[model samples]
Target chain A: MLYLALGRGAWGELLAKVKVAAIQARPVGGDFRHPGNIRHALELLDECFRMDDEVQVACFPEYFPWSGGDELARKAEDLGMYVIAGLAEEEGGALYNSCVLIGPDGAILGRQRKLNLGLMERKHFGFSPGRELHVFDTDFGRVGIGVCVDFWGPPNVGRELARMGADLIFNPSFFFIFREVWHCLLLARAVELMVPIVAVDVAEFPFRLGDKVFESCGGLSCIIGPPWRDLDDFASWWYEPKFNWILGQLGYEEGILIRELDLDLARELRGAWFSRLLGREAPWP
Target chain B: MLYLALGRGAWGELLAKVKVAAIQARPVGGDFRHPGNIRHALELLDECFRMDDEVQVACFPEYFPWSGGDELARKAEDLGMYVIAGLAEEEGGALYNSCVLIGPDGAILGRQRKLNLGLMERKHFGFSPGRELHVFDTDFGRVGIGVCVDFWGPPNVGRELARMGADLIFNPSFFFIFREVWHCLLLARAVELMVPIVAVDVAEFPFRLGDKVFESCGGLSCIIGPPWRDLDDFASWWYEPKFNWILGQLGYEEGILIRELDLDLARELRGAWFSRLLGREAPWP
Candidate 1:
């Protein structure tokens, strides 16, 4: 029972005219993972803070050296915008795909382990499904996190997250050229949540994940919400995704994908006008 | 108001199976139409009687003949099906897509033209919107007819038909591949009618229309109602679309797909199930 919606944005087929803040990620050895350790990762975090002083959150591509979780959680305190980046987790000689949300105070806010494992993902990295959705409270608002395939399950994951009090949902994705199904799923999730579900697909850099190196995953760093409240004022509104500098093919080089949050719309729209059809009673828990 | 409902058979893939007494249609040259010409079309009623004897009625595809409608609906009788088919009226050299229904007695039962159309369709053949949907009486029960795409517009076509007095509805559709969006509309129509609807897709021989062949238009024919049904002994316990004689795979060749229908169940589940939902108002017309 929360107020939420998404700002739908177009994806990049080719780069164009906007300036963007890009989070250039480098590999740290995956072998250096611990539940709570960080030295070199912290140094890397210092570089991220220095590069974008106003960055609220910096994202990383999937399957990078993810051992920096606890460290990013701490680094978020200094970075101020918080940190949500992907990392390959090492546990008991096995690897798991995971994304962590580090709080502005550098605390571990939430974690969502990838649920749908590709054949190679399951083989090279033994990933077990994440059991529950993660929605945490922050001074900014209630935020939720979900990895790629976790968003695809038919039983309404996005709606569930919205119902769990998420004002913002961060979806860090790695898209592919032959893949059209996932794009539709992302749009459906945004419509279902009716909140700003920022889906950041990797761009430019190609890295090998098994036999393939994906050079361009395409970028559609969108701010999805219901139709803009004032069509005339759309260009100037802070909540309007078009106004977010982090969007557009050209804008996201290294600037923050920023937008102000309004927590009330998710609350009032539930019953006053359009009934929550997604919340209709069904034969499930 | 007349009671009406729209129904379709499942997976009416063309010529996939050989049907025992399936109706085969050949594209005719002259104008073929039926509008308010009940006794006129019923003249060849005995031909259907000679072929199948107890056929009750047979259906044809949408716009079976290239008829000229402005000329007092010329060639209203040559429409092939005991049940009339959709027609494209050639006027001012422009085309108006339509569907007309004839009976086993060769009477014009009713005709409903399609209203909503897509871009490609609008470009190729012009269509006039169907303003209303109504049902008429028959020996079997109150029945109605609606063309393809008519169901897509608010589904009020079926609802209005049901409200008018249709216990059964015949919806003959023509499309290369079965669209899921149409299926969703069918599901919604069945749920709303609380009556039986026999949806028969225009299953026929593939040939050329203009540049398109008439017989080569592979069709999927079906008869869907309550997926399960219990009827009076005189009433058929089950209907089967076992006509598997579709040959050659232009990929559209699937034969008659029939399934027994249970109208009573529509009343049971979608109807007044005696104090269901803790006494909410009846949802159907």
Candidate 2:
């Protein structure tokens, strides 16, 4: 239960099903309006405190703010464990699409906003949306709140946060859009919410994603584990930025895209490879 | 009327409504006693008469007689055009998947037999489904026929050949089942038949679709037109004969991928870049 990730350059630990991290976006926009990206998010949380061991969970990259920084929520309550980010809220005057979460006693455990804005986020930087969705109870069990195109491919808000019983399911995305619509809509909302998706995107977003976009939102910062995970099984992950190609011309993806899901092979590739062949009584409408 | 094609490498060609060609199959072990590849139709009709130009119709890929050539209908009457190839016939004793349609005055302007034969063409040949369909009106117009998973993508026979009018729809494919089915189902059947397709595949057979099973079918040859083309235009023609590689390979791109169909900017990309606002109706259905 200690995975960890934050690609764009380098960062990985993934011992198996949990630890998770990931923060590669470098767009410098999204509300707080980049202050050199909060000094690169405090130099990326001082390198996620020398790469955690037991409990971790860094995550970021949906709004990437700092314009006001209430001491950046007291630096994730002094970086204890779960930080989870994505910002750009504005309350009354409008402009939402937030995320928040912070724990390990850093406070805040619930925020969620972002009800499918996308498509140039209401004509670039206007945000709005987030109507209902709160979920979190965490320790490790019932945590919820899907942001970023509200858990895409319409997995009805993570199947209504797994019918309001959520086991995990954070989301964080800034998916600049298009890449086979993020793997056929976020890997079919982590294989139709059986649960266990950590997701986080934005590995170097300053621009450019046109050559038939296969980037702008993928390195599959996935942590998802539940039915089907073996993109040719190589232990998982590829959205590298910060490192790989020597800072891939400054875009990002340092490192991190690991996997070890044995949550019963995600319930046997989603109940025997897609519930006896594309479940819900298959045969697409 | 210089719409020539007859390729086997990059992506084949054929337009009007849409036409792709190739049946270059090889695993005779799939039985039907292997026959029609006529030495890959005289080495892909001598590379389409060294880069075809005035054909108006040309295709071939399925089992071009399992590469056992000598007479590709006298090289389609010495390349006068109108070929539409694919073969593996063997009548009476059963074993169709054919194509024919010679013309350039060579005659036989029709023959189609391949109404879907997947799963190793229903276990080692002995096919049997294409009970009828010739549609060759000529002078470059009503062309029709289907084979190799008849334009698969949820049982679609090009809207029953544009509701039986078909201005052009030939498709002699081998779409290389492997090669990452190139982004799910041949670019969604060339953006759902906006017409003018020509998809051959089998640039280099002779075994090694990794020795078959689990996936083989090579080549990628494609050419989808109409919406003024851009499913990422291509042109290589042929390859897959030699080499090892950690990263070491080059040399192979037969020719002919031409597009120039300003046919009035494909009718001004039919109102809003085509997806159904189909201005002049992509050609029926």
Candidate 3:
């Protein structure tokens, strides 16, 4: 009764399930401003769409689109699917690293600009950090997005999204090093927030920048859910005869990782693990 | 100059190097209020002391000594080593899960009470939570301690300790279930705060609670440090010749995990990674 009251009644019908896909793309080489790079990115998007016809929402890696938001929106509209793609937007001579969520209606539902800037982004690219964080309401559920480094900083962007009633958080990252750190951080964010996370990372990309060569994105994209184990013994946890919670995971390769999230299970676990601790009316509610 | 200035001035001599140990002990069964359990805990402490004589600071698992705070303090003075051990304290008709740092001078330097309570703790034990967080300054460095569940919460207790100028955070955890979450959270807290962490977990202990028998603490104690790799290529971040930052780690077994931490390296990396982003004057400073 408490779960139903706190978990937005009509939990079964209103939030049935969502099939999501994370497209781990290989990094683009040559001039990033080149039109050919944009074409290559679109080709990857087409591949992702073809990989799974039932994927209601598809996510791409950070800075995948070179330009042309209108074309991307039109493509999302044609496919009748929600698409979250990361790109760099130049406005009034200032560039902001941003993630745009395009609705099935071909309109931009929301945009989350990267709040934290990496060393290279600040000194080399002159990119200005974003000031606001936003969560978008979609057909499946409320969702939030955070670009690569934004998820890495203190006052974690994912936690803020979880606080904003996001059932799922999408992290589009371009982490080129410390693959172990990326995996660990993703798990930390998921467990800490008690929310499902779909994190898409870039594949191994070797590129020369001036005199230095950069490689290794280690595309280990994954879909993580809340606590799935129940205590069978007072000391040990037992997870069996239940759902195989880890939907899908990929490692250091360009692939479309798709999984159907059990929204009901997420809500149930959140209630059992987090909500009950804080009393009936949870902070996220 | 910026690193030295932001890093509290003393570059080398004062905060040179520290050898630390995390002792993962099996929990004492029967009555938690038993005196024999306290003697058993002292035996484990003796084993840890015998394991590494060079270890300046050693940490024990949560709720090691069933009682006797003065005995633990006297042992630390006898060994001439700083010791952090977890125990439960009864004060003013209320029970609190606490971790006390015993100075080598046979004095109780400080005690950190567990801020968060687990489900079983709240329901079965009637444990009252602590309100304040404290960091202790030892001869080696500024140290902070968190008992079990306190380290698992968001706006991490370890991060708060780091903000309080704690160079090394000792997380004495009794995580019996979800071993993967424990490992990931420790790594996440370490990397996010850019501070070294020595997390001592309990070994597998099977005990009967009512009708069911639960087993597992899964020892896996580890000493993790700041970023170990220096980029061979600024853009690629490829490590050619680098020191492995994780000094030592133990599997799910009763053992002493010892590692020498280079304070200078931690301060340097903190400066390189975190300090430059927020200008020169860090909030921690």
Candidate 4:
């Protein structure tokens, strides 16, 4: 059929089912250099690995244990799982909010700089914005990271990532606003990109920049997938969008949220509709 | 100050408050040539005008009257309201799904052809797709129309329209699938485009193409607005996206659903955030 002809890659084997964990870590008194905070975040990662040995990927929200790149790299190697977490990177006397992805082999895979800097980040913190976007190949599939407002505000960042064949997108956010707005925006991105989004947010914390204290109402970290996957069942074609398709989520609390994603199913569902609708050789724009 | 600087047009006045009606119409039998169907649809339009003397714009679902161009122009002139409705156009032996906009002065303002054609539309019906997109300036503001699948599948059609400064989008659909899925897709479009979407769908009807009988599960006609408008209140910043921003909606029934849309507010909200985040003078991509 047209779907099979225009679909990406070969049907092959559906062997890319992956379990992911969102480590909703809390900040330690606005101090990324705090040894105790780094240690506590490491303990959460280790606990997550112990809780689910099958977990292949683990993520943390923005700037929690912010300066623990070496520790996370070591932990990923020790646990044999890919680790993605936010960082407050300082280079040449400039600060930029970033997310680092470490391979299971203990090597730093890559880092995605936050492209869209928030108002406070620019005016108060004097943060610099990133210029480019990237997608990395992993054992499970291709992955992309969108830090905080980078993915939420501009649809282009996430759209470009998905167009580059990102099977999954990991969003590290320190959203200080309402959680529902974030949820709605994230859900919309997931549906539009046709990619599963694993977004982890920091627990509610008081962020201090200068004399301004902004309390982040975080902990709506969640995983969202395509709703069209249900179309496989003939009856599901009549299903309503009344209910959200968020696979797993955490409320306003500090915890670890895990969910299993079927990358094969996502690809199939996305390919079938996009190919049929787009009628182009490429599955996407 | 930055928002006012980069926002579209002068914010000297916020005078545009448009009363719009979505005529959730039902097809009469299976023929567009049926006089009864055209008469019924026109009567509904008249009732809508009588009900709200201030109603500025009125819309109908795709292909309800199928081929009533002259009558709608006359009705728009008589009622002094802009009319947007779908049609089945036949040109040079090629058929296209189109939506026409009739001005209050009985002038054919413009027509937008469906850029994306569905599988059934292409194969069974031999319908051709349109090449260009346009935005029509009306009494209230700039308006764009996305016919059925045109606005749902691809993000560009709506994005391009929004980028071109469409304050309000009128989507005429004969969605035959599940209503919930349609709702979710349209909601995503409204949020992403930052434009108010008035989507009117036909009631449940059995569409017969040759011997194949396809039932359209329609009647999810609705008006959706941006959630960011609520940010005017400082407390609203904490409000969740839990409650839908759909101003008005109709269930699986034939009726006239009307709602007041503040185009001025939509532009201000979209510009404020887009300019702040995008940091560009255009306020859009």
Using Cα atoms, each model's DockQ against the true complex is 0.04, 0.02, 0.33, 0.25
Give the per-residue lDDT of model 3 (tens digit) for A170-221.
Answer: 8887765566567667766665676788888777666455566556545788
lDDT digits (tens) for residues A1-285 of candidate 2 = 321231111233322245555665454543236567766775676576565544456667567642334545677667666666777778899988677777755676667877666435665467777778877654444567677555652334666776665556767666543333344344444433445666666664334332333234434455545433453331222111010111111124644433333333443343343332222321112
lDDT of 4 by residue, B1-285 (tens): 222332223354323678899998888875544667777778988999888878888998877677878998998999988888777788888888889898888899899988877666688667798889999877677888988877875667788888777888988987655455677677667656678999999876776667655564678899998655444742344323233678889987788898998887777777655545544423225
The interface root-mean-square deviations, each candidate in sequence, come to 17.3, 18.4, 5.2, 4.9
Candidate 4 is graded, for docking, as: acceptable
Residue runs of model 4 more than 4 Å from their true location after superposition: A1-15, A29-35, A123-125, A204-216, A226-245, A277-284, B1-15, B29-35, B123-126, B204-216, B226-244, B277-284
Docking class of 1: incorrect
Model 1 lDDT per residue over A138-198, tens place: 5445667667545542324555776676666766665433123333444444433455556
Off by over 4 Å in 3: A1-16, A27-32, A153-155, A227-245, A275-285, B1-16, B28-34, B227-244, B275-285
Task: Mark the regions of model 1 whose C-alpha exceeds 4 Å error after superposition.
Answer: A1-55, A91-94, A152-155, A176-183, A209-218, A230-256, A266-285, B1-285
Instruction: Judge candidate 3 at residue B59 and give its lDDT.
Output: 87
Candidate 4 residue pairs in backbone clash: A241-B180
Angstrom error at residue A124, model 4: 4.9
- C-alpha local distance difference test of each model: 0.45, 0.49, 0.69, 0.75
lDDT of 3 by residue, B118-160 (tens): 6656665677788889987766667778677567556457667
Looking at model 2, residue B10 earns an lDDT score of 24
Predicted structure 1: lDDT:
0.45
Candidate with better TM-score, 1 vs 2: 1
